[model samples]
Target: MSQFLTQLGDAATAVEAFLAECLAEQQANGTPPRLAEALRHAVLAGGKRFRPFLVFESAKLFGVTREAALPAAAALECIHCYSLVHDDLPAMDNDELRRGRPTVWKAYDEWTAILVGDALQAFAFELISEPGRHEDAEVRAGLTHTLAVASGAIGMVGGQMLDLDAGRLPEQPAATIADIMRLQSMKTGCLITAACEMGAILGRATASDKAALKTYGEHLGSAFQISDDLLDAEGTAADVGKATGKDAAAGKATLIGLLGIPEAREHLDRSIDAATAALHAFGTKAEPLIEAARHMGRRGS
Candidate 1:
């Protein structure tokens, strides 16, 4: 467990360093001081950085070096941070805080927040496509395409659209477990799945190995959303680093709301088990990934 945590810390450090360099380069190129600063603020916000850890760990399966995987890992973090920025906009979830700091929209203005998301997303593609970072044209193209699909309308954005649609209808019936699962899969699962898939691309993983990592990500993503819902239901804003109970207040359909806390917890455990099981072929080397799944299940507790 200590070793797994240490790896996560190391992953976070590598990813952050790359992201800092990217932002610094943009600043040096005169990308506008405010825009660069906003990009840095949003991307550098402290978090567990779970997605990047998946990238690094999954790539390790194919003997890929950390430096080789850093660009893709940083790209994933950019997309993740961009989504958070847009999700916190007034037109979206309208949160006032994140990571225990004022949300981009709250810290700056809504327009700046919008631009920050846009710029970060563009930078994500730039980082993944850079020749020095990715080296191989084919692999870089694959990484670019994978990230595009994950963050596009068919994935995270589509899920957010569904979430918004769900709350917009006052007379709508409560969402079923299946409905909630689908939403969670797209909104949160897609990018996380992409992170693992990106690792496979970086390492030239075989079909079977890639499939296993993808499965691990799917279960892990579901567990992550379940854990998030649990935290929002029970945790304080200070501990959660954002407003809690917003989902319930918005009448958002979550596993907890549909299945109750105990059943939701059961489902979370099952997902975690499936996640760990998906990597069984990797044997002892899969410990970090297994620990990551367990960590997802225990986020709020």
Candidate 2:
């Protein structure tokens, strides 16, 4: 467990350094000063960087070096940070804090926050599409295409739209467990799945290997969301680094609200089991991923 945490921390630190370099290069290339600052504020705020870790670990399974995997990992992190920036908008989640600091919109102005998300989203594509990311054009293209779909209307954005609609339509019937699952899958699962898929693409893994990683990502994503919901249900804002109990307060549809804490915990455990099970094809090489799945179950925030 200590080794897994160390590895996770190391990945986070590497990606943070890479992202900082990317931002610096953009600024040097004539990005406006204020915009660059806002970008830094949004992207540099510390988080677990769990998605990037998936990319790194998945690529490592195929003997890909961390250097070879860093671009994709950083690109995925940009998308994630952009999502958080946009999600914190007053028009969205109305969040005032992120990573225990003032959110982008709260720290800056709304327009700046909007531009920060826009810039980060564009930068993510640029990073993935760069020829230097992979020698083969096809690999770069695959990464770009997968990332687009994952972050597009059919995935994260579409899922956010569904969540917003659910919150607005009080007259409609409550969302079923299936509905919640689908929403969560699109909103959160797609990017995570893409992180793993992008890693496979980077490593040029076999089709069966890619499929196994995808299964692991799918189950891991589910477990991640359930853990997040559990945190909201049971944690303090200080511990979580964001508002807590907002889901219930907003009458949002979540497995926790439907199943109660104990049942939701059981579901989370099953998800962790399934996630680790999916990595069976990789043998001991997938230890980090197995630990990652278990870590989801143990998350306190």
The residue pairs found clashing in candidate 1 are: none
lDDT of 1: 0.88
lDDT of residue 285 for candidate 1 = 85
**C-alpha RMSD for every candidate:** 2.8, 2.6
In terms of TM-score, the best-performing candidate is 2
Clashing pairs in 2: none
Candidate 2, overall lDDT?
0.91
Please, what are the lDDT tens digits per residue for candidate 2 over residues 136-231? 998999999999999999999999999998998668687999999999999999999999999899889999999999999999999999999988
Top candidate on lDDT is 2
Could you give candidate 1's per-residue lDDT for residues 1-301 as a string of tens digits? 4666788888898888888987898799888998888887899987878889999999998899988998999999999999999999988888999978999999999999999999889989999998888779999999999999999998999998989999996777778889889988999999999999998999999899999999999999998899988887767445545554777777676677678779989999999999999999999988888998988766644
Per-candidate TM equals: 0.93, 0.95
**Which regions in candidate 1 have their CA more than 4 angstroms from the true location?**
236-244
